[model samples]
Every structure is written in C-alpha cells, then in structure tokens.
Target: MAEINMRQAISDALWEEMERDEKVFIMGEEVGVWGGTYAVTKGFYDHFGAKRVKDTPIAEAAIVGAGIGAALVGLRPVAELMTINFAFVAMDHIVNEAPKLHTMFGGQMKVPLVIRTAGGGGRQLGATHSQTPDAIFAHFPGLKVVSPGTPADAKGLLKAAIRDDDPVLYIEHAAMYQVKGEVPTGDFTVPIGVSKVQREGSDVTIVSYCRGLQLSMLAAEQLAVEGISAEVVDLRSLRPLDMGPVIESFKKTNRAVVVEEGWPSYGVGAEVSTRLYEEAFDYADAPIKRVGQKEVPLPYNRELEQSALPQVADVIAAVKEVL
Candidate 1:
C-alpha cells in the first residue's frame, strides 16, 4: 500500500493505464503542455510525448467529439474538460451523441471514452464555474457518472472507467485533490456503480458521495463524540447507482441523512431520500433529512461560498434531526 493524495492517485492511475494500454491516450486543453489544469497530469506531457498526451484547442465540443471519434475507431481516449462548467458547452455531444452512439449503431461501435472534470464550490470560482450538476448527467440513461471521495477510489475508479466500453463522466471535487489516503499497489480497479459503506455505525445512516462524502465522514467523527453512531455510505457511482448498500444500511439504522454539495431540490440528496422511502418505507424511524448547499448562485466571496456549501455541521445536524 502507498499513501498518496487524490492528485497523485489520479496521476498514477492515468500514467499506469497509458503505460499498460497502447490505445489509451489523453486529450484536453493544456493537458500536454500545462500538465492538466489540476496538475494531475503534470509530468505526463514529457513522459508520454505529444502523440499520447495531446493538447487540444479550448473547444470542449471538439475535445469530446474527437474523443468519441477516437473511441469509435478502437482507441481509449481520456478527455478532460478543465471544469465541469465547461462540460455544458459540450452538452449535446456528451448527452446526445457520445451516449447514443452504441445503442444507435446497434452495438456495432463502442465508446470507451472517459470524460474527466472537477466540480463543487470551494475555490471561489463563482456561480457559473462552481455548480455541482452531477445529477443532471446521471439522469440520462446511457452515460455512467462517478465521483470518488478517497484517493483509493479515485485511482481505482478512473482505471475502471478507462477500461469500460461505455462513456463515463468521472467527476473530481476541485477542493479534494490534496486530501490524502492509502491506495493499493499494482493493477487493480474498483467496479463502478457500487456504493461502499465508508463508516459503519448503528444509530443513523449518512448517505453521500464526492465532496459530500468527506463532509459526512467528518460529521460522523463529531457525532461519535456525542455518543451518536452514524453510518456513512458513499455512492461512488451515480448513474449505474448501486443502491444496495444504501438500502441495507438504511434498513439497519432506520434513519438516514442524505448530504450533497448541490441544491437539495432535484439533487443527489433528493434522489437518495426518495429511494429510501420507496424501498425501505417500513424501516423508517423518522423522515429522512437532506443537507445540501443553500439554493443560490455560489458567491465569489470565500466566506459566502463556504457558508452556502454544505458543511460538516449541517450533516451532523441533519443526522440528529433524522434520529
């Protein structure tokens, strides 16, 4: 096992995958020269050279379109959008074209493509760039959405997404690149669409993913001090969302608090809470509580931005409320 941050973990995953597979290549703005906007691919340009580590123009549509074309032609392309907000510029290609290609072509072609981008509102990037629209992408049937909380999952999931024949949108939390955790050595991949119980407890269940999972874990720590045992479930994959762990944890605890970085309405929290009610209505001890960002444009000021985003305190309070 090796201890590494999310940034290094992601970098290691990309480097190892490219080394192992000749067809795996990277294309994005500043990926080849600038070494990735987040520095996850910092040394890849020099190591992999221009042919494999490509630098594209600032057009997200072109990047995604070209990636789709490459994938259709039997190459695995990891396309990076500097930010998740830029993904909207290429929404039609992402949602309409890349996803529909396999089914539309009657399985004659495969899009082994991975769209990588970071999301969340902690960098003071303002409302436009700081939105968490993961749920929007997951709503579509064909695309697979994944957001990992720990460095281990980040590395494993990225490797898995690159190997999978389907197009996967792998979202990283902008603020979580520095967070460190232990990662396994050698070639291994975590299966996508599986939820893992991050912290096991008995009193209540805290459901979250990505940035929210970090907040939930911190909240669980605090809750423990108060003699409140809070079980935490990380929904690592959103689209092919595996609700098995969530349902099992909810059934055991009989109470839940769903936490997410996005707005509560029509957000991840809403989806999890609704599902819990649908599948485990009888197990509920109280109505499930949702803690999410304040429904407003994320402010440019750091203080306002932090206040608007869901916090550890919010998760703790929601857990207490649900209990």
Candidate 2:
C-alpha cells in the first residue's frame, strides 16, 4: 500500500487507464497545456502528448457533446468540465443527450464517456462556483454516478468509470484534493453501485459520500468517547446505488442519519432515507434523520459558511437526537 492524496490518486488512475487502453484519451479546457485547472493532470500534457491530451475551447456543452459523439464511435473519452458548476451550461447535452444515447438507440450504441468534475464548498468559491449538483444528474436513469470519499476509492472507482460502457459522472470534492489515504501499489478498481461501511458500530448508521462521508467518520470517532457507537456507511456510488450494505447496517444499528454537503431536500440524503424506508423500515427503531447544508445559497462569510454546512457537531447532535 502507498499513501497518496486524492489529486495524486486521480492522476494515477487517469494515467494508468490511458496507458492500458489505446482508446482512452482526456479532453477539457486547460487540460493539456495548463495541466488542468486543479493540476490533477499536471504532467499529462508532456507524457500523453497533444493528440491524446487535448485542450479544447471554453465551451462545456461542446466538450460533453463531442465526448458523447466520440464514445458512440468506440473511443473512451474523459471530459473534464473544470468545476461542476460549469456543467450547468452543458446540462442539455449531459442530462438530455449523452445519458440517453445507449437506451434511445436500442442498445445499438453506448456512451462510454467519463465526465470528471469537481464540486463542494469550502474554497470560498461562493454560491455560483461552489455548488453540489450531484443529485441532479443521479436522477437521470441512463447515467452512473460515483463520488469516492478516499484516495483508494477515488483511484479505483475512477479506473472503473473510465472503463465502464455507460456514461459516468465522477464528482470530486475540491476540498478533498489534498486529503490522503492508503492506495494499493498494484492495479485495483472499486466496483460501482457498492457502498462500504467505514466503521462498525451498533448504535446508529450514518450514510454519506464525498466530503460528507469524511465528516461522518470523524464524528463517529469522537462519538466513541461518549459511548455512542455510530456506524459510518460510505455511499461511494449514487445512481447505481448499492443499498444492500446500508440496509444491512440499518438493520444492525436500528437507527440512521443521512449526511450530505448538498441541500437536504430531494438530495442524496433524501434518496437514501427513502430507500431505507422502503427496504428496511421495519428494522429501524427510530425516525431516520438527515444532515446537510442549509436550504439557501452557500454564503461567502467564513463563519456563516461553516455554520450553514453540516459539521461533526451536527452529526453528533443528530445522533443524540435520535437516541
């Protein structure tokens, strides 16, 4: 195992997949020459060359549209939209077109395209630039969505996304780029539609992904001192969501809390809560709780921003409430 940050892990995955498959290539604004806006593909421009590592125009729609077209023709394209906020300009192509290709064409085609986009607040990027729109795309039927919470999961799931036969929206938290975790030295892939239980506890189950998962795990650690055993379930994949582990956890814990950086209403937490209600309602001993950002645009003030977002205190408080 090797300790790597999310940025390095993602870079390794892209490089490994591109090298392993001739059909795989990366395209986006500043991806080639600028080494990507976040520097995830820092050396890709030199190593992969201009043809494979393309630097396209500033148009997000054109980028995703071209990616969908390329995928239909047999190539595996990794298109980066810089930040997911920019994905709004290309939602027509992403939500309406790319995800519909395989089914609309009667299985005669597939969009083996991977859209790598960054999300989450905390960079002081403000309301417009800092938004978590993952649930929006996950609502669509034909797309796969995965937001890995650790370095290993990020590396593994990204490889899986690049090799998948369906369109995948791979969301990375802008704040998680520097977060580090152990990754296997050899090639490995974390399967999609699978959720992992981060810590085993008997009191309550907390379901979350991305930055939200990280915070939950932290809360669980602290909750241990108070004799409140909290189990943390990481929702690594969303659309092809794996609720088996969550259901099993809920059955064992008999209490639940759904956490997310996105707004609570109709967010990832809503979906998890609904699934638990439908599949494991009898197992839950208490009403399912949810923690997320306040239902307003994220503020620019540091103090207000921290309060608006779900914190470790919020998770602990919610757990106490349910108990």
Candidate 3:
C-alpha cells in the first residue's frame, strides 16, 4: 500500500473510473484545463480529453441540471461544485429532479449522478465559502450523502458513488485534502451507509464524520492519556445512516458524545442524538452529549471561526461530562 493525500486519492478514483466505464464523465467549473479548484482533477483533461473532462460556466444549477439529464439518459456524470456553498444554487435540481426522477416515475428512470464539492472552514474562506451544508441534502429522502474523512475512504466512497444507480452527494472537507493515509493499490469500494469504528474502546463512544472524525480521533488520543478509553465511530454516510454500530458501541461503552461541525439546531449531531435516544436509551449510563458548532452564523474573523467550531478541548470536555 502507498500513502497519499485525499486529493490524490480522489483523482485516482476518477481516473480509474473513467478508464473502467465509458459512460462516466466529469464536468464542472475549472475541472478541465484548470484541473479543478483544489487540484483534485489535475491532468484529467489530458488523459480523458476535453469532451469527457469539461469545464463549465460558473452556473451550479446548470451544471447539476445537465448532470441529471445525462444520468437519466444512461450516462454517469460527476458534477463538481467548486465549493459546497455554491451548491445552494443547484438544490432545486438535486432535491427535486436528481433524487426523485427514478422513484417518482415508478422506476422508469435512473439518475446515477455523483455531485462532488468541497466543504468546511479552516482556510479563512469567509462565511460564504465555508458552510457545511450536507445536512440539507441528508434531509431529503431519495439522495445518498457521503462525507469521507481519510484518503482511502475518499477514494473508496467516490468509486462506490460512481457505480451506484442513485444520486450521491460526495462531500470532501477542504482541510482534509492534504492529509495523508495509506491507500491500497487495487480497486476497492466501501459500502455506503456503513459506520466505521476508527478506535475501539470501552468507556465512552465519540460519533462523527468527515473532518470531525479527525478531531474526535485526536480527542480520543488525548483522553487515552487520562485513562479514558473512548470509541470513535465515523458515520461515513449521513443519509441511510448506519446506526447499528453506534447502538452497539453505546451498549458497550454506556456513554456517548457526538461531534459535528455544523450548527447544533437540527443538525446531523441532533439527529444522531435523537437516534441514540430512540434505540439505545436504556444502554446509556449517562445522557448523550453533542458537541457542534455554535448556533450562530460563522464569522469571517479567523479567531471567531475557530471558536464557533468544535475543537479537541471541547470534545474532551464533552466526553468528561458524558462520563
């Protein structure tokens, strides 16, 4: 196995998928000659040619609408919105058309489209470019929402999304693109809707996904030094969320803390807390605690942004309170 960054892993997946399936093509802003805004598709235009690797105008709704049309006609189109914030422009097409076409039409159509976008704050991209809006898509009934925390998961889940017969919202954290991890040489796919226990423990469980998974892992390491063994569960897919592992972990650990970077009110963490209460209330030794972004609009100042999001100290404190 060779280690690589999240960006490289995603590029590899796209390259391999284009080679494996002629129907798979990529179109987005700066995806061709510019090699993508974050360089995830570097050199793709040269390998696949301009027709397959297209650079679109700065119109998210049109990009997504074209993707939906292509997917409905039997092509697998991976449409990229430069950032998740811009995805708001395409919500109508994504929620109304891409996810509903097949089921609403009684299985007469298939939209095997993959919508890839960068999300999260940490680079001072300001409030407009830094919002994590996966919660909105996850709320919709027919869409598949995926957020990968590592290089391997980024590669595996993207490949899986490209192959699936439904619309998949593949979100990549902006900060995690440079993080490196070991990735297998051969092709592999991590099933959607499966939660992964990153660290095994017995005292408490920390559930999170995407960049929050990294934060929880760091918190787990710090907690271990203080003799608290915390299990970290990464809910890779928000929609079709896999709560079995979460329930099982709570049954063993008896204490749980959910970490999410999104705002607390009706956020993914809130849903996780609700699910825990619904299925694992009796197993919990203490009430489930949720650590998420402050219930306010993210500020532009760097310090304020940092304060609004969850940190290792916050996770440690939340875990302590839950225990």
Query: What is the TM-score (0 to 1) of candidate 2?
Result: 0.99
lDDT of each: 0.94, 0.93, 0.92
List ranges where model 3 is wrong by over 4 Å: none
Worst 10 residues of 1 by lDDT: 314-323
Candidate 2 on 1-323: residue-level lDDT in tens?
A: 99999999999999999999989999999999999999999999999899999999999999999999999999999999999999999999888998888888798989999999999997877889889989998999988999999999999999999989999999999999999999999899999899999889999999999999999999999999989999999999998999999999999988999999999999998999999999988997889999999988988988888878889999899988888
Residue pairs with backbone atoms closer than 3 Å in model 2 (clashes): none
- Could you arrange the candidates by lDDT from highest to lowest? 1, 2, 3
In angstroms, how far off is 116's CA in candidate 2? 0.3
Q: Higher lDDT: candidate 1 or 3?
A: 1
lDDT score for residue 79 of model 2: 95
Residue ranges of candidate 2 with Cα displaced over 4 Å: none
**Total backbone collisions for each predicted model:** 0, 0, 0
lDDT of 1 at 237: 98
- Candidate 2 local Cα displacement, residue 179, angstroms: 0.5
TM-scores for every candidate against the unseen true structure:
0.99, 0.99, 0.99
lDDT of 3 by residue, 123-142 (tens): 77777887887788899989
